[model samples]
Target: MSTQVPPIHSTAAAPMLELRGVHTHIGAYHILHGVDLTVPRGQLTMLLGRNGAGKTTTLRTIMGLWQASQGRVLLGGEDITRLPTPAIARQSVAYVPENMGIFADLSVKENLLLAARQARHAGQMDEERLQWIFGLFPAVQKFWNHPAGKLSGGQKQMVAVARAIVEPRDLLIIDEPSKGLAPAIIHKMIAAFEQLKAAGVTILLVEQNLAFAKRLGDSVAVMDNGRVVHAGRMADLAADTDLQQSLLGLAL
Candidate 1:
């Protein structure tokens, strides 16, 4: 059976992740400009924006891949703005980039084994949890010994996600899980996220697909010009076409 964490019921609960006036610069180019964002505990928050809007930069800053030049990144109410990527990961935050980082040379099983820090081998990994993940993405178990590089795009995305959850994670950050996926595969991806939400894992996603976002998002933040321009309930955003057009330039 899945282990259930207490669900977050109110805005009063401490946010699982918070970015306060965060600014980031890469060399001479200033990317993020005083972004203020709050990801409520135990909810899935969608980060939406157009190209060059700095959505990826926000996620990268949260992961510490890019250092925030100003303000702070807080996790469970603690400052982590300056922490290195590995140190930040040790705090139980898992990030999957747009590329879906995985060791292509390794078998699917080996890829998951690496993510499970407590497990030196497949046998040492949590069998119950592995079985649960297998149920979520059957391709993981079906091609256990196949090289990750050999799998199709959709299968590889499943493995990438499965690896992130191989060990329990307090926060899961993903960039565009449905990008380039077929409609059928997108539906399966949606189902997997639904299950994750029910399990109370706090998730932050950057997606261009408004339909997918509307279906899975509990809260929504829209970024423009390196700042969060809009924030509100997903249901509210879904209901207001004029607001959607004004913020996102399109209706959901």
Candidate 2:
């Protein structure tokens, strides 16, 4: 019932993360079917798919939240398929789920403080880095003392990303950062991600917004029926309207 995806060539000399023939099962339902993906180092890779297409499942599997039933997940040339979630995170990888994952009961500052392993208190967190993050997402500074739950959706999203980057990370994986956000907030998010990429962070994003993907992604992989149906440069996919509609069921 599924159409086949032609092989996608590697655009980067070396990939920062790769999923090779991965399979994931949820209860009796098989989610990912031999998914192959590559995220190049220091680049923004977009994972796009229709609903029920297993984009989030793929991200979760990479994060070790859901164990892969088969295959390998490589990070920086190391096999991390079986590592625990914390261990994976400690490997300089950060994952932000769709829920924004901030502690609603904690203040924005507290939430960020908790994310930094070296910092016990706000004073202990890297001052220069914190300032840089604040500059990228000013909402974080504006709502510093407010409970994360009290902030608006967009501000909370900022806190979530700020927490992920509270410390330097090699890879950052986020799920649908633009979901339910206003156009203006989404634009700001786009800018923040651009800055993060500039700071040498390799990012893997599971997004449904075509405009967001086109704006920020250097590489793209499209999933359907749990397999990557397309992989190539973002510009290649963006420029081909017919191919976009075929893979994603919509024009770019």
**Candidate 2 local lDDT, residue 173:** 98
In model 2, where do residues sit more than 4 Å from their true spots?
1-14
Q: What is the TM-score of candidate 2? A: 0.94
Give TM per candidate.
Answer: 0.94, 0.94
The residue-by-residue lDDT of candidate 1 on 1-252, one tens digit each, is: 976534333234679999889999999999999999999988999999989999999999999999999888888877888899999999998999999998999999999999999999899999999999999999999999999999999999999999999999989999999999889988988998898888989999999999999999999999999999999999999999999999889999
Give candidate 2's total backbone clashes: 0
For residues 1-252, could you state the per-residue lDDT of candidate 2 as single tens digits?
Answer: 976644444344558999999999999999999999999999999999899999999999999999999988888767888999999999999999999898999999999999999988999999999999989899999989989999989899989999999999999999999999999999999999999999899999999889999999999999999999999999999999999989987988
lDDT values, one for every candidate? 0.93, 0.93
